[model samples]
Target: MSQQQCACPKCDCSVDSQAIEKNGQRYCCEACAIGHTDGSTDCGHNCQCGK
Candidate 1:
């Protein structure tokens, strides 16, 4: 499969096999998948959005 950016609008992290799926959308991590609704500001990845 091809790589794609996280579903989160603020995140630019790429997702692969570790991608987190939510409602048909793929994210880099759980944080992004849930739209950081848990008060998280990052996806726990080494990316600009997570910084």
Candidate 2:
């Protein structure tokens, strides 16, 4: 019974199996989901990406 995690490479948030799926990757939030589509890990806000 391990909890699933977001598929965003730069994200460390936990996600459910029914979380947002994009391009076969699971994202905890919309920012992570959209950011991943553009190859950006910034999450569109002040994050580790520094953008």
- The candidate maximizing lDDT is 1
Q: Which parts of model 1 are misplaced by more than 4 Å?
A: 48-51
- Candidate 1 lDDT over residue span 1-51, tens digit each: 899988888898888987889999999887777777777766666554533
lDDT of 2 by residue, 14-34 (tens): 778657888988777777777
What overall lDDT goes with each candidate model?
Answer: 0.79, 0.67
lDDT of 1: 0.79
Give the TM-score of each candidate: 0.82, 0.57
lDDT of 1 at 40: 78
